[model samples]
Target: MPKQVVPEGARRRRRPTRQGTVLSEELIVRTALRLLREHGGAGLTARRLGLALGADASTLYRYFTGMDDLTRAIGDELMGRALDGWTATGEWRADLRALGLAVHSSYLAHPQAAVLTASRVTGRPREIAVDETILGILRGTGLPDGTAVLIYHAFIDQSLAFAALDAGALALTDEARTGDEGVWATTYARLPAASHPHIAATARLLTDRMPHSAYPAVLEMLLEHTAAQVAGLNRSQH
Candidate 1:
């Protein structure tokens, strides 16, 4: 990537607000994250961000090239937070499971931001660190390098894909979320048994369970299959 142009001379100096809070790229990205959380996706505009930071909208351009650059920075921050306290155990399967859950939970915590950033490959420092850490974990499992790379691709993609999809649901407006949450209970549960035997038969279970995201269960399945594959590869090598 080409070097992002920083504003010249005077603009490079810290700009203090009337309240004495200094503005910098870090502060801007942090404020943007808050704006995204309090307001939804549409709330993350230059005007709103400026208001939130107590700086002029034009000041933002001095820091970020545009909204896209700021967003990628925010995404990199999210990746950093996911692995904040994570240290890998020598046990590969357990370590991967922990990392996967950490990533999922971090995105869920910032659903609005995740909606914008989860599918993106930011290539920023923290994002690159996450990619490296995951690949290392998979390779340590003793899978062949080729197999490790393939599984690493699948694991990371699946985790982020589901995170984005689930976060999209969570990011809905209150009314929409409520209506969606009630679908299994209100719609599926009410279908006549004569017309929808299978759905009707399991409607009670579905109503009780369907409102929850299934990412955790799905992650476990992926990890278990990968473990099985690794074990089989080890046996064959011996």
Candidate 2:
């Protein structure tokens, strides 16, 4: 089939069929996301996507070159959602914290999709904007150019790494998720105090807290260390 060339940033034109269902790029991407959520990562094939969208599997290629292209679009959409409605305050540390939390929360919102796309570098609009925003924030810290770049690399990579890892845990099958959650309460809590004194001493707290994702705490630690480094730089420059 010939490629259907669509203009950049143009709303996907929906083609109405005798079946009465309209198909567009946005519709395809949204359907793919839904399939991923409902059926897990293996659920997002072209056949399943077509079945969900009420179109032929071949119809997807008109919008995306193939499944890989489609996945990248999905990744970009996640990035778009992460930065949506986000405005940076002039305070660099506060702004970075808000941005980090926004990214983490957005990924957790669609854990299955996040597992698939969180590590991808989609050079699309929203992804590009996010990269630029991170660099801009780091530069605003008054660090030397080399230091700002290094911190930018660490900050962005650390956020994405944690987001992907946490989302992966969340994207597990229901049975797997239940089993994993139970490990802290069922297994660890049952350990003998004589054999594991430290664990037994704090078993209750561990069981309560271990079920929660550690992304927020980890992100705060990263920001705090970065802030300390920035402070050191300021002191050295004076």
Candidate 3:
């Protein structure tokens, strides 16, 4: 028997799912984020995503090549949100601080997704845009190319590294997370003065400071050092 031919357009066309949710790359990434938030990293398989979208698992491949590709898209979506309404205010220090905080907070807001993607190099549009913005801000400091690149690398990696650390703690189960937090108050705060003089003396301070993310303080220090470097360069040019 002769085979019947299907038109190219018909083959490419996809109908809306039972829930009337249209599947696009953006939609998939957004839905994937919500699933990650609700179920954590391990629960974000294609089958689950399909169920959440009210569609067949195979339907996702129509948008993304595979799960890895989709994961990268999710990472890019986070970056896009980080920069969504952010604009540079022409002050390099203030701008860098704002950008760093924005990126860090964005990751912390999705701790589960950050666990999966914090270390990934998406090389997608949003990630590339972030890199470009960072380098541009660094260059605007009038620093040499090597220095600008060095600071840019350090700044970005530091932001992600801290975000990943904080997110990991945030991603823990409720009881585990609470137990971890309790250590500062129960164990560290109760350290014996004779055995550990410094820690014992400063236990109260440690307990107060340890629970918060250190990204902001460290970011301020980096910005301050960068500003000093810019000043030295300016002095040398005179």
Candidate 4:
């Protein structure tokens, strides 16, 4: 499908916030984000981003101090877009499941932007809020604070790790075409049954699995394990 046109506001020029001139983090991030999506990870350098925004590379320096900062901003912005309209109903498991799936879906949606954002936590507002929510859910389970923090960290990391890896492979990596198939055929299916019985048993299931179901299916198993951990903790505390 043809990508959408950049709104006039999304472009940047070296100028202060003046009566007629509009300079914003959103504008800069969005333009760079568009470029990142279209050109893959290597294309999001400060020079190319500037050119895409109709300005010199130096103009971007005014908005973002450096490429790393700019990349983080772009990652945070993409996270925000992925999180729009998400509300919780106080069902902790469902809320967390929803949150994880939301983030995964969002990151996967813009696999380009996600390739950069998923690995690093910029401590951006949306990310902080997401963290707070996850920890809050764990705490609500009545576990001690330390335990809650550890579990929450593990859960968040795992979800993002899987999400980011798949996104990177699908959108950012060069072997997008056959890397997935190679893993299924040459790696998992080839393992001897005596050495990897479970994997070998599930080889056909793994082989028949479609690309789209990969993230969500793995996410379900993660949630199940996490939920059991929470349950175990609850029992121990009682």
TM-score of each: 0.92, 0.87, 0.93, 0.77
Which regions of candidate 2 fall more than 4 Å away from where they truly are? 1-14, 18-22
Give the number of colliding residue pairs in candidate 4.
0
What digit string (tens of lDDT, one per residue) describes model 3 on residues 143-218? 9999999999899999999989999999999899888888988998888889989999999998889888999999
Candidate 4 lDDT over residue span 48-85, tens digit each: 87666666667666666578777777667656665674
Q: Candidate 4: which stretches are off by over 4 Å?
A: 1-21, 172-179, 182-203, 210-214, 229-238
lDDT per residue for candidate 2 within 1-238, as digits (tens), equals 5466455455343566446766677777788889989998888898988777777788787678788788999988877887995787888888888888888888788899989988888888888998889888888887778988888787778777888888888888779988998999989999999999999999999999987877778778878888998999889988
TM-score of 4: 0.77
* lDDT for 168 (candidate 1): 93
Candidate 1 to native Cα RMSD, angstroms: 2.4
What's the true lDDT of residue 63 in model 4?
60
Instruction: Give per-residue lDDT, candidate 2, residue 145.
Output: 82
Per residue, candidate 1 scores C-alpha lDDT tens digits across 56-111 of: 88778877778898899988888888899588878888889888888888888899
Quote the lDDT for 102 in model 3: 92
The true-versus-predicted C-alpha distance at residue 134 of model 4, in Å, is 1.5
RMSD of each: 2.4, 2.8, 4.5, 7.0
lDDT, candidates in the order shown: 0.86, 0.83, 0.88, 0.74
| Model 4: lDDT of residue 176 | 57
Q: Candidate 2, which ten residues in sequence have the lowest lDDT sum?
A: 5-14
Quality of model 4 by C-alpha lDDT: 0.74
The best candidate in terms of lDDT: 3
Better of 2 and 4 by TM-score: 2
